[model samples]
Target: MAAFLAIIRRDLRLALRQGSDSLMVVMFFVLTVVLFPFGVGPETGVLERIAAGVLWVTALLASMLSLDRLFQADYEDGSLDLITLSPVPLSLLVMGKVAAHWLTTGLPLLLAAPVLAVLLHLNQDGFLILIVAMLLGTPTLSLIGAVGAALVLGARRGGVLLSLLVLPLYIPVLVFGVSAVDAAVMGFEVRAQLLVLSAMLLSALALCPWAAASALRQAVE
Candidate 1:
């Protein structure tokens, strides 16, 4: 347990020292969402109609921005080798790093989401679902991204590779996240969409760590 916490702490400390990734991701999400108002005009109705999709897509892209570094820094500095040698289970260690990634990247995006949603004149009816959907979805993004990040550890143009590998996987989350908000906006029940999002999150939680850890082992070998 201590080692698990220690890995999370170590990754968090490193993320803090190298702060640009998180800052950049948040800024990208804000700027991308902000651009929609100008491009589509400031009509509240139009903005509200599109807000769910805009936020979900931008958040998806922004989340991808920092994933390449999740394992790259450790791998480059030989810390990854040390981690693999540790007595702690590699999957647990990978989960710790994934948690740290979500803390630095996904969590910030989740927090900034409501502010951007308001900027788009999002429907008040959807706000709760939007927040709840993102809270459930963003961590799943980090978890799946960890696999992509680990898979491309030594590959050329890894950022691009990571995106290619992961973006397709992200589609379901994007679909249901937007659906939940859109459903709420339309006065429809969002329970079904939220349930699907929860199921995906649970599935990711059960599988992604081990997949990422296996990829890490392959990368180090």
Candidate 2:
């Protein structure tokens, strides 16, 4: 318990001290949201209609921006080798990192949605669903993204390649996340969509770390 907390604390402190990564992710989220008003023109109806999709898409891209950092620094400093040799299972350690990543990136994006809700003219009811759906859905992004980050740990053009590998997988999250908000707007129960999002998170939690761990092992070989 202590070692896991220690690892989580260590990563969280590192992420905080070196703040650019989290800041950049929030900036990416904000910038992408800001662009939609211009690209789609100033129709509140149009913005409201598409806001859920736009928000999810921006979050997906912002999360992708941070993926390269997951292991890149450790790989460069040889600390990743030591992590692999540690008494703690690498998958647990990876989960700690993912937890920290969610705190720094995913949680912040969720926090920022209210401001963005205003920007996108999201209805109050829809705003709740958008935030709740993302709360459940974005952890799944971080989990799956950890796999892509680990897979591309040493690959050239890894950023581009990571997007290709993960974006298709992201579709279901976005689809259902947006659908939840849209359903809320139409006065339907969004609990079903929320259930689906939670299910996706659970599935990713069960599956992604092993894939990420396998990729990390291969990266170090």
Candidate 3:
């Protein structure tokens, strides 16, 4: 328990010191979402119709921006070897890293989503549901991304490879996240969509840490 918290705090401290990683993620999210208005024109109805998908897709991409580095820093500095050698379970350490990643990346995206939704003319009725869906979905993004980050730890062109490996897996989260918001906007029951997102999160929570840890072990070996 102590080691888990320590790993999270250590990563959080490193993230705070670097700062640019988190800033880049938010900037990418905001800029990408902002571009939609220009590309699609200023029509409110059109923006409203596509807002959920746009925000979700952009957020998904933005989340990917920092994933390749999730373990690369530690791996490069040889800290990962020491971390893996620690008495604490590697899976728990991976969870701590994922939690830190979410705090720095996912949480910002979650907070910024509602504002961008407004810019996209997302229906006000869907605003709360958008938050709810992102809340359930973004952590899952980090969790799953951790595994990809771990898997591609030493590969060349890892960022591109990470995207290819992870994007397909991200589709379900994107689909359900957009669906929940759209359902809310259209006065449909959003419970099912939200439930599915929650289920995915739970499943990721259960499996991703262990998978990422296994990959990390192989990377170090």
Candidate 4:
């Protein structure tokens, strides 16, 4: 327990000290979402119609931008070797790292989503549900991204490879996240979509840490 908290704190401090990684993620998210208005024109109805998909997809991509760095710093500095050999379970450490990643990456995106949604003219009725859905969904994104980050450790063009490995996996989350918001906007029952997102989060929580730990072990060996 102590080691898990320690790993999270260490990563959080490193992320804070560097700062740019998290900043880059938010900047990318804002820039990409902001571009939609220009590309699609200023049709309020059009923006409203596509807003949920645009926000969810842009958030997914923004989250991926920082994933390659999730383990790369530790792996490059040889800290990963010591971490893998620690008395504490590697899976627990991976969870700590994922938690830290979510804090730095996902949390910021969650906070930023509402503002961008307004810019996209997302229906006011869907605003609360958008936040709710992202709350259930973004951590799962971090968890799944960790496995890809771990698997691509020490590889060339790891960023590209990580995206390929994870994007397909991200589809279900994207689909349900957008669906939850859209359902709310259209006066439909959103419980089912939210339930599916919650289930995916639970499933990923159970599996991704162990999978990422195994991949990390393979990378180090």
Provide the clashing-pair count of each candidate structure. 0, 0, 0, 0
**lDDT of all the models against the reference?**
0.94, 0.90, 0.96, 0.97
Model 3 lowest lDDT segment of ten: 2-11
Candidate 1 lDDT tens digits, 117-211: 88999988999999999999999999999999999999999999999999999999999999999999999999999999999999999999999
Residue pairs in collision within model 3: none
The most accurate candidate by lDDT is: 4
Candidates' TM-scores?
Answer: 0.98, 0.97, 0.99, 0.99
Ranking by lDDT: 4, 3, 1, 2
Better of 1 and 4 by TM-score: 4
lDDT by residue (108-148, candidate 2, tens digit) is 99999879989999888887788889899999999999999
Q: State the local distance difference test value for candidate 2.
A: 0.90
| Candidate 1 error regions (>4 Å) | none
Residue 55 displacement (Å), model 1:
0.1
On a 0 to 100 scale, what is the lDDT of residue 167 in model 1? 100
- Candidates 1 and 2, the one with greater TM-score: 1
Query: Tens digits of per-residue lDDT for model 4 on 1-221?
Result: 99999999999999999999999999999999999999999999999999999999999999999999999989999999999999999999999999999999999999999999999999999999999999999999999999999999989999999999999999999999999999999999999999999999999999999999999999999
